[model samples]
Target: MGREKRIEYEGAIYHVISKTVSSENAFMEEKDYRHFIKLTCDAFSKYQAMLLSFALMKNHYHLLIKTEKANLSQIMHEINSKYAHYFNSAHIRKGHLFQDRYRSYLITNDEYFINAFVYINLNPLEAQLVEQLEDYKWCSCRYFEDKDNAPRCLNFKEIHNLSGIEIARITQFIMSKVSESKKYGREIKEHNSEENIKKIREISAEIQNKYGSIVKNRELKYLLVYALCSKKFKLVDISFALKMSYATIRRIKNKVEKRMTSDAMVTEWLSEIGKVNAFDYQNDHKVPGTL
Candidate 1:
């Protein structure tokens, strides 16, 4: 199947995710992260997009943005391409730096928008990269606590106006315990149900049975990981089910996601698996490419 067309419109809000190839570090050091932030500031200024929230992870980064015009594709292309060029040149590497084109999910409602904002802020915490959200210097979450020091890339005033909530309230939501905050999102709530678990298991088994003979063990594992994640199962849930560490599961998922974009065979296998039992592959409430 061909790539899905992005939904673009004036004043559209999006939850965007971009990952590096093979789960490599996108930011190798503090300077690298700072440089990426500089690029982001430039991109926002050039494109007239409002950067509401962001989190830079080891291998991936998330952005919650609102575009003034129907040009999200152009904005992201410039940011990713320019950053990729810089990263490759600085690191003295060749070939694609990013896994694929960034994935974006349209934010349609205030509640969902708030959820995405909190979700982006909580990424570092969820990955166990920081003991506290404040410790993660790469994320915009810290700026919320100290707006006076926030960089030009973020627009706190516009965020407040668009979200219709005070910054304090949004910060409170983000600072809530993971268990409580996880309950607010529709995707998380649905994935917690017994029915979703059953479907995920069914899908995993079908993929194994269909492709176990031809694919290598590693490849098959990634296929199962992709199936579970695409169905909205949390990384923790998948870790337990697959008997792998959380980090490993996440890496496998990223690998599969990258392959799906470039490899026709991988795409065909996943597309066939999605057909089994007539499973509902379309997750309307999910912010694609999120944790």
Candidate 2:
């Protein structure tokens, strides 16, 4: 069987989709996600590829990128292979991590280019992994949102020139697309679905029992807030569910955000609890009386 040709050339733009084999979560933990992001940045630097936008979902990722040189094949190979190596070594697994060759569509026209950009940015929200685009910290959406400190890997100037749309209008355009995608997604009808909210409470109670002696209430509050936020629950709803005031919920959320940004260990256990809760939910496991 002849290998499929990747139409490569200097200055070619493409929408690339990479998936994991058997729908396994390629990035199940925060550290794994961070490592992949670092490898992606390295690959971009190595190949001189211009990343317009990207979103890293659990089992797959979407990238809107332009090649500065005809090196898409080399770039993808390096990124995927290196990440697979790291994942295999860390997880004690073997064999192929990626499903197959990455799927890519050439962005030939301006309309498709803009569509690809917005679509990539909306992946997390559409998958119900996040309530909003900005909430997904791993995405390049932040680069577009924060113009003053825009990413060097992402050439906003090139995107602006190609689309003839100013940077000032980019956020609004992306927001509109996100709003449209959410309409179809609508995965979580309410911020606090009763079942999931109950799951959150159960997870909290379990954590409190195990770590309550050593952990302070303030730290626990930070954990709860961060975990709920990561699960796509609204602050107001989390406040109501956890019996905290809106102001307190917001404060805790901010504290956790700052800790995470500063790479502190504050509420790291709580985040682990959140991951456990998610795993439980997926496996339909019961926790004590919660059954």
Candidate 3:
């Protein structure tokens, strides 16, 4: 039978678990664990995902997440695939590290939510790997025990929303659940923002260097807009960065997305462009003597 469909929706929360394919420890050492954590952080940044809690076990791991967009597949794919790459290269092994597709349970109620959250944190203690949750270095339990030590990847806003007098009370609740087997768990526009614009300018400069000159300013604009969007930057940020009007930025983004998705000519042209150094082509403008 085909794989089951995931229940997906904007603002949907899920408890995601995945294990190594062979029962071998995917995280073989401290560095391996830290590397995976780094990749996890990168996924958070790229996807704008909210990571409420997580635990990294020897052969398996768990994550409690709420996505701002309906993009669980994309988020998980990036995290798993990227981590797999790093794991393989570091271990000098070749093959699937994770077991079959990740298993995720949708959290539709507070009961399940609390259960998953506590369950994940208690994984180490349940496994007898550590006597106290605070001693486990990889899982997020330490951060919950001490907020100052929490990494940037943790989403405290949601944690603070818990129905408790203070964070300490919430931690106590999570700890109680853990005793029961564990508990639950941007860039700107170019000008006004130097960072994104710097990226855009770099791409523009490379294209110019490759093609000798940008045939039209619109081509330059399209490239800048496309680069910004690819970074998942906001349209408003793109507009401010490039000093373009919001409508113009939106138009470029929409046109680029439309053409790239539907127009064979545009797709082939982009592929060809990527092969060589990035270069600008006039918008709807033929190359020299083509028209």
Candidate 4:
């Protein structure tokens, strides 16, 4: 079966998660985690994603984000690939550092967002990495506490919306949680099961880079081919000219034309990138036409 289609909606919030490959720890040191955060910052600047909250753990990481017109898959790939490259080179290791696919749960309701925020803030505590959440150095917990290196991750507006808690109360709540978790103990289990079942609707809107929103894929492919082709043709005209599925459209854009290409071209190209293997735009080395 084809890879499951990820649910993407405009202004959608997501709790993104990923673990180290083979259960091997992804972070060898604190510096590694810091580098991962740095890379995550880079990805946010490059993509159309907005960070409501984010936290990096020892074995796994979490990102509570809101996306506008970007694909989550591409965004995660970019962030993970860069971090992996950084970690591998730094540690002198040579294989996959993270699991194959990152887990993503789209958050469309306030309840889920709240739980996600709490869970993310309390990750270190849950992992037993630190006695208190704030004690963890690499997490949104510190971001919420100190204003330094913040405003990049924490969007206080969302926090302010919770029970009319202004920035002051927002900080108060977080600070209070830290102290409460310390006093009452971080061992207190925060239940997200009920909130996770919040009603969320799935959406399917196409937003290609620089290109406008496209609903159909067949024409998408035709346009991709046309762009690569020396042949001059209008997208509007082509859209009406041939009606094709969006997959065909995406395939066309990716230069995937099984019958159109010669056997030699097919063999050589397929050998490099077949059905199961394709160039990952997330990786600079895997990009086509780049030396």
Number of the top lDDT candidate = 1
Error of 2 at 25 (Å): 0.5
- The per-residue C-alpha lDDT of model 2 at residue 67 equals 95
Query: Model 4 over residues 1-291: C-alpha lDDT tens digits?
Result: 876556665676677778888778888887887777777767777877777666676677888787766477778899888888888899889988889877676553454466566667776766788886567777777665565667464666665564255544453465455444343223223322212222110011111322333344443333344332322232222232234443453455445454335445433332222111111222112211100
Candidates arranged by lDDT, highest first: 1, 2, 3, 4
TM-score of each: 0.62, 0.59, 0.60, 0.58
Best by TM-score: 1
RMSD in angstroms, all models?
A: 15.3, 19.7, 15.1, 16.5
Please rank every candidate by TM-score, starting with the best: 1, 3, 2, 4
Error of 3 at 231 (Å): 47
Model 2: what TM-score? 0.59
Task: Report residue 166 deviation for candidate 4 (angstroms).
Answer: 2.9
Which lDDT tens digits does candidate 1 get at residues 1-291? 986446577898888888888999889889888888889889889989999999999898999899999899888888888898998899998788787777676665566677778888888888889887778888988877887877787998888897787886776667764554465444743333223334455666655565562135666667667877886776665664455787897888888877767777887656555665526554222111211
Error of 4 at 286 (Å): 53
Pick out the ten consecutive residues of candidate 3 with the lowest summed lDDT: 183-192
Give model 1's clash tally: 0
Error of 2 at 251 (Å): 62
Q: Per-residue lDDT tens digits of candidate 3, residues 87-178?
A: 89998989888886877766645555666677777778778998777899888777776888776888877866642326666556766664
